[model samples]
Target: MSQEPGWLRPHGEPWKRVSERLVYDNPWITVTEHQAVAPTGKSAIYGVVSFKNLAMAVLPLFDDGSTVLVGQHRFAHRDYSWEIPEGGGPRDVDPLESAKRELREEAGLEAAQWLPVMKVQLSNAITDEIAIGYIATGLSPVPTDPDETEELALVRVPFREALEAALAGQLPDVMTVAMLLRAYHMARERALPDALSRAMLG
Candidate 1:
């Protein structure tokens, strides 16, 4: 008999699940408690938060090298926040559509171009929340139709300044921070258009 290739084998021993219970359920999230056996043969209890939708964000870039940010009071954090246009995309929907809707609803902007920047996990240790980020250009005005629950303020700032704010911890939203940093990296590495990159760098 031929031996199995190392690459064909499992990367690690799988956890043996003993039991799982639904701890909580909401429109957007579900929490579950699980009892499992570890790879080391030790029993463990774990809690996992699962999201019903994919988190999506967009960095709207203008021809002038400026970007739009949305400011609002976050109830969960009980603080004011400035972030890129972000919202939840239903699992069955395309994330780009969600990003476009959020940008229009939050900032009243529409884009002729959309470049997906990154996909990431928000909190792997505690939550199974995934986020997709995009850079939107070729912009135009649109009518804002924000969620009634949102009381938002729009701010237009130079891309570099926004990035600086994000780096300085002014923008605490994970999606915003990561996307801003990614944009900066892309500009510096010439991953973006020369004109656009030059405008943003300035």
Candidate 2:
């Protein structure tokens, strides 16, 4: 292959092989060391992942147009965090399934309808993690089945209020914020044809 002018030539056969190997990796993430040979040959290692899986956050709008939010203790930051119902187990289950499961598990709510609102990529730096957002309308309260390790509370707030809270970091979950933002715009633009989503836009 002809060398690209702006691109760097690998230091040696070892660096070239490593770079190629890093790009075509499998499930697990990998890192490769390389040095630029053009303007400057600064040595660096690039971390790469084999495209992350998708997660889901279900924002259920009640009959009154209020959206459901969940408050749970986030062990990562040792604080109670507020977010939409969201979780992911494995790729075996569809992202929508994860959304519905999380809604029931965390918020004790079930929706009669669900709509795909947004698809957000959590991190593009190295991993390809995507968060699929859903708008669940026609909600009804139900029994929640939280695990022993989970302490979750359900809050139904106005959609605008929820958006404000999410923007203010009161929701604290990065994935939740990204999902909401994307869904909010979709709802606003009338991109979602569902009647329930009109409440989300409203």
Model 1 Cα shift for residue 172 (angstroms): 1.2
The 0-to-1 C-alpha lDDT of every candidate, in the order given, reads 0.93, 0.72
Per-residue alpha-carbon lDDT of candidate 1 for residues 1-63, written as tens digits (9 for 90 to 100): 999887997776787889999999999999999999988889999899999999989999988
Model 2 lDDT tens row, 1-202: 9868865765543322224344454453444433323224444565545433467788777755577788888885898888888876456777777788888888898888988877777767656667787888778888998878887887778887888888987887887787678767776777655674676656
- Highest-scoring model, TM-score: 1
Worst 10 residues of 2 by lDDT: 12-21
Give the TM-scores of the predictions, in the order they appear: 0.92, 0.70
- Model 1 superposed RMSD (Cα): 4.4
**Deviation of model 2 at 71, angstroms:** 0.7
Return the clash pairs for model 2, or none: none
Model 1: lowest-lDDT 10 consecutive positions: 6-15
Q: Which runs in model 2 stand beyond 4 Å of their true positions? A: 1-43, 47-53, 192-202
